[model samples]
Target: MAADIRQLLLAAFEVEHHEHIAAIRGALGSATPDWNDVFRRAHSLKGAARAVDLPAVEAVAHRLETLFERVRNGASALDRDGANAVHLALDRIESYVAGLKDGAGPDMPGDALAALGRYLGLHGLAPEASAPPAASRAPVAAPVAAAPAPKAPPEPAESGAAILRVPGEAVEALARASHDLASTLAAQAPAAEGLARLARLARDLRAGAEVLAAGAETERPELRAFAARLGSFAREAAELSRRQGAATSAIEAAAVRVHAGAERLALVPAETVLGPLARSIRETAREQGREVDLDLQGLDLPVERGTLQALKDPLLHALRNALSHGWQQPELRRAAGKPEALGLGLEVAVRGSRLQVTVSDDGPGPDLTRIEAAARARGLLAPEGPADSETLLRLVFEPGFSTAEAVDTLSGRGYGLSVAADAARQLLGSVRLEPREPAGTALVFSLPLSAARRSLLLVEAGGRTYALPGGVVERLLRLERAGLPLAMGRTILRHGAGDAATSHPVTDLAEILGPVSAAPDPGNPGGAPPDPGILTAVLLRAGGGRLALAVDRLHDVRSLLVLPAPSFGSDPGLVAGTAVLPGDVPVLVLDPEGLAARAAVTSAVVSAGTMAQAPRSTTASRATARATILVVDDSITTRTLEKGILEAAGYRVVVCVDGQDALDRLRAEIEPVDLVLADVEMPRLDGFGLLKALRADGRFARLPTILMTSRGDAEDVARGLDLGADAYLTKQKFDQRQLLDTIGQLL
Candidate 1:
């Protein structure tokens, strides 16, 4: 239990530590540093380190708190040397945490405190403090250099440790990133709560000061100065509280970015992840006294690791099954004038957006007679009816139907082919047993290919919005969740009323994605409404199966690029990647096949908190910064004028060269803002196109948008509004005050 607790603390510390590093780094580099915020971060990090038993980290953090405390108290100024020392300390802490693995983290670098102590002019500080807070506790240990960050996220995986490329660096990068998102398990609620308490206390103190001002004590000049200071303190506290809330959201957004960037490493050759499987097969053959030639092809072709992992099990089963039933003795092969060794081949290829993996063997084709007999004995086929070759071959997949006269290690209680079939079905693919030319058999598994999914189905489950592959969407519909038919302890969604209705087992999307999560979306609520189930639902199809995924809302469908799944928060099985929505929102792109397979595991009517569902969306909009306004125009004059106006109005403004530039910025989310102001007439993707793109994206569909152009035609106004622009303004009759008012109303 103690070990378990220590591990949990390590996990929490991992997240907390990364976030503190980011916060502290930002503060140190800021021209106008938030000294109080820096002090709190150091204090929090110290506590987190102590909890995780990282004495070196705790010791460094303690000295940092003292340094920042003195700075805030005006006892010392933060100069070049001081800042360098702080950065060195942060680097040391990051390096130490990055080296941690499944158990207690790698020992922290020893010189973290020494650097900070040197900056503080402490002669007694040890280079490696063995015991945290050991002013008199223990002797100093030797100094150790800090670890360096990985060059990148990681290369795509190939199985087996010996042959796999540099993965330790990747693991370190992941561990380093594993929750900031060490993508931040953004645990800043306490910070926010602490701010709230501070605000209340300051408010009370200010009230007391005001009372003093109203009394005869106001005559005292010192009392007046004290009152003014109290008023300023209260105001600052209130501002901090508001900013803390936004900071929490910003941290969540940064977590998304870190994880999404990791996707850049997602693409790699199939051999990267499949080499180990092939080697394993070779070893198995040697042990079984079987001689086989492995004909592996198309493995050089690039594919995502997620897709490769899903294919791993079926391929293994298929290869082993070939060894068991498809291999013939060398004597029989010579009589047949065939190769002495069995030809077992695995071939992968892509046809459009579909992927196919064929496992083949040049041996006696499937025994139709044996399969037919098994089917008949098992009552899967009529005993008297003539069985076709196809029917007999497919019957080999029947559970518990085996041709082996006796159960053995190799073949018994037929489950290999069945496993392949189940996997194929789950992938929305099919497993077909076909007779290869000239005495051989091939099992083909076909399914939708995994790539950078551009066409997406936007959906809301719980309170967060997620992106699903548009290809998997069979249809969209609304099913009343209040009174659904029950069968075998499952809620069945019927397409039609009464007996004519087609039944599909209903599974709440939230049940799969988990309890509602995310910061308050300016556009949508954070979770499901008071009513748990919504009328909106999406009917999803994957491979050979279909599922009715009940959801809080069905947002919109758009074509967009996808990034890698977050390492810390998401389930590797469910989330394939993260899609950046318009307005720079990062949403999870769920695996439809995974969802289809989850129907059985997720109780139909259970609470929506069963699975450890990754948080789907973070606050995409920038916090701390003023409400950003994206100004799109081809003319430099128009862009300059609009930018100046918005900036003067207390809005942070970003100008794009044209509609295309604006659209690109929005798509890349380089500038996540609260609203968009664009000129309708521009080169390469007009305002209409931008507006249409924004409306089509679920993230920015409801984003406040305004169309301001020279054109004053009624037709243009009608068209702009039809495209979902919140407001249409014309420069021909432009009023500066009117523009600000309109923007104000929208914001």
Candidate 2:
């Protein structure tokens, strides 16, 4: 019986206890208090506390119950002191409950209990007698007159209709089953298409048979019989096609229902997490002696449970930053002609197939001057020129980068935005700072609705199938060979006509991913064309620029179930994941942002190399005729800075974001490149890989190369030089003159 009571107390008592405390607090300073209702709630809490053998909790509740009973019986009047005492008692009870929940023995501050007793005595009420020795009476960091028995085991929290706690494993299992079913259904699509083709052929056959029957004479028995047989076969084929079509439709509907149900089960309403978030903001504001109004929109929007869990910390960090940094003091706001209480708003909505959540605060936007100053101090900005808005904004997300003058508990350490950005990346989402109109700043997070399932455009490149997320692709084009122009030793495509015409850098997908021995073009009759080839470009919108990826062929669009790549030490950044296509064919899903960055760097590097060998004649020389050099690095800022410095020195510069891209460009270049300057550590492939590839190739074996990287350890330098590098330089010791002299000597 004691064990049963303990379970009940743990499961349901805490919730009831919290409600009672809230009621007591709410009734404070009221014109008329509900004495009878308060008495009943206190009585119930006291009984549950006694059953659980928590003497400290029961004592506080018992005192409250007695006082409220007096008020209900009209023996005592509720006064301000009485309200104060009740609040104190409730606070003490909450502390004990917290201790028990922490697996510490049920305990409370003895002084607080004594204070409550003294207050009751002044009201002409006698204090309740202490509990018997059998009850738990653990001391809270102090010795007591008598101690009770050992504490009982803690039980699970009570279940409620308002919230459900589902096991993570169960959710994962359901997701896998759904994905498998979808894959199977996708495989059946081709068979349905085949049925349609068969039906068309059957109709054509019947038409031919009718013509033959009309032409045939009755005297020719064999010809008539042949025509009749053909007509019968055509009718049978048509009937079979009709039945298959209906069955296919039914199967498709069932698959859609299953997929929809599974996705819904894996998601929860956005409001599920927003309630606690709002409470946290209010409590933090109260602590800081500030007034804030937080409004949440689209609370009913559904988001994946995993995504919500990942976003919890990031959202908390954002809120803290908004309160501590984005909002102005109440008095300051009034002086600035704004509302006394700052407004912080969070709006979540489904945009197309993605979920976008924006957090905005009505305060002065971030100071660009301060951010630029910080970037300069951290050596992240160019000294001669002012940083762009995008560059300055990106500085806020850098680790240990802050504009605050001093450190504090809230945000000065500079980990908030960095952590938020990192979390977004891990979830395959992006976070950006948007400029709000008039004033304030908005942080936007865009994430896939279902990370596992996504709409992908399948294409064939290098004789291999790869999937590109449909969201990033702008358009597909088959441009004439004559329209492609060679600029700075790279191919450029002119898109649109008339006023909207714009030129974009074009890269062959086969060159970026690796070469597949040129296969015969099925579309072309004879063989591979000479000189210029017809370009099939996939225009992509990445960052603030447009990139065109030239692929061999384009296939159908499909909604694929993307699975995580196996952890066998392969490059996962370039290949986001893998998906099983129709006919059980597996295809790699490409990360477009990474690909675009690589393409930009590659084009820059190739241009640099081409300029190095250019003729000096002003009339005869083109931009590609100058001394060309290739600069490779993963950081866009670093790559841009290097390109600027080299280009300013009269050298044509091309940049590659990583080693793999550099190697690909080197292999695909028709003209010889003069030099290769690359960073040491990068994704997909590193500097050593590039150097090794260059040395192994007969054409580039004697090409001048320099390694510039942040890894400046003696052993690293030695390793790079040993791998056939002409010179190895550390970024910490980088100098424009020194780099130029090294390249000149090597060339």
Candidate 3:
């Protein structure tokens, strides 16, 4: 527990240090530095470092604090040398903090102290008597050369009451539990109100009895006594009603507070991650011999811990890529009539239900010629035709598809962009590459802002409740059945007029993922008359694609705590997660990308115009043009079974033992394989390895690969897709007809 506390404190210190550095840099750039702000930050850092038992960091922070204080008191003037010294001190502090994170001891090194003393001496501030002499100090302008700090004596562990550090997941779980309880309590509100009403009714009954008794008092003296008793009963009932109402209100308010507090606990400002990210960019740019400037916006936005955690590495990789591949050398940039220092801009905004993060670089945009050449060499593009810009740009995300000529510490192995894309997809988000006009490239990542608290539009489809992210829904349309248009073998809805108008492809939500309902069909009437009833369609936008989902009914929008669905039988692609409703009812949170992909598939199937056609045969004349399939499996039975199916369908096939063997064959074969069918569990390597390897090789980065496994779990499927698989099929659900159809679609 003490160790955990130290870790938490270290993380906090790291964030604070980065923030202070950014502030100091900004302040130094001005006509005058904010001495007070600098001093306060340094003091805070010292306190935090001491709390975490990081003596090295604490010592350096103390020196910085004293220097800043002297400047604040007008005893010393801030100058260029002084500013550089402060920056150098900050760098030392950051390095020690980083070491702490890596499990290093927290004692300040002798050389680091010597360097600090030198910088202080330059500003006419002498070091303490115990400190090393200035004659042994390193240059103030040079980077700090310090050995590891000496280990400090262990202190007595504090009681849990003094400081408690909780894991982020635990906090999230508690928050979710609180939300669920609150929702349950809210659902009982009507019953609570009903109880109050019952009390009111009892009072009314007593009052009625009193009135009856009062009227009869003239006939009988006994009626007068009964009337008084009835009045007393009425007073008691009214009092009970008032007390119950107050109690209910108090309970409801408490629930609300608990839920609110839990939510706040689960969120941290996005700036917490930005500081380190910006620092990393600067460091990487320096290492790469490139001069780049970073501009950041929307750092103050709140982001869930989980989202921020998942984004850190991907963002880092992107920054590295921007510095390494996107920006040219300063001399080259100047020669190209560009600024000596390239500009990398990062902007974060909450768009709808998604957090949109854009990273753009002011450098030469993607080289389509080189991309096309690589794609053709790998058989990804036809040799005879020019590939479109969008298609060429997408190649950058393909594993092992770098345009760089040689491998380097930064990017040459070709996994950087792919990793970024994978991380986005894992979050049920998307990463897109857009070429900037004139010059440069922009990478945009759109992710769900928070899994815990999402504004979901509850919609009923095929008698099942599904939650669609409210942010993705552009607008709701209610149109008569007859108003639907049939185009390209799918139903479409056209909205607006003239240039302002748009047409959206529509599909039934029930038919996409749920059991089919015997509902009236307007798009396909089967020669029957179309229903004249109004139909509701939800228009959704996912990345560059748009689709309208038709549901049986639209329910109320709700803010729900989405929980990950169990791996069993769920499709991560379609089912984003699950959320519990007020009544303990669970609803699937639909992924917009999955829905869009399904819609596209449906449209393509219809447009193919091959529903009634027979399979084409491979004649001698067509043999050379026939598509090739690579069947990889450890089991001979599986391989033979799959090969026979493909060959019988008029395709050539090659068999491999496992992922490793398949990769070797792919690399050695002169002819490119059209697709790979590999099993998940195999010797040497598995299906995921095969997929990743194929993607990592520039030659086959875009090759279609399908994972066939008996595991049939959501995690397995998700993993395969995350590694760049085209499709995932379970053995139990596999059939010759389905396999052929899937293969045809992919090809």
TM per candidate: 0.32, 0.40, 0.53
* TM-score of candidate 2 versus the correct structure, residues matched by position: 0.40
Best by TM-score: 3
Q: Estimate candidate 3's RMSD in Å.
A: 27.6
Residue 265 lDDT (model 3) = 62
Model 3, stretches more than 4 Å misplaced?
A: 1-19, 25-36, 43-55, 58-88, 98-176, 217-219, 268-276, 289-291, 296-300, 332-339, 345-347, 437-439, 450-747
User: Candidate 2's error at 667, in angstroms?
Assistant: 75
Return the candidate ranking by TM-score, descending. 3, 2, 1
Q: How would you encode candidate 2's per-residue C-alpha lDDT over 1-747 as one tens digit per residue?
A: 766556555656667776676566555535577777778888888887766666667766766777777889998887645654565466556656644642335546554455456666777875544222334464332212222222222221222332256676666566555545544554555566576667778778767776776787666666667767777777777787788768865765575566566556666777555534654665566457566756677866777667877887788788888887777876888888887777788888875445788888988888898989988988888776967898788889999888888887677888888988998887767899867887788889887554666667677676566777654565565555553444334455655543245566578887776632222333332534332445666777664567789886666666677765445533444566667865666667777766776676565444221112222344333333368888889999999998988788677888888999988988999445788889888999999998988888888888888888877553464356556666666677667876665566555
- By TM-score, the better pick of 2 and 3 is 3
Error of 3 at 620 (Å): 97
Q: For residue 449, what is the lDDT in candidate 3?
A: 60
Q: Lowest-lDDT window of 10 residues in candidate 2?
A: 607-616
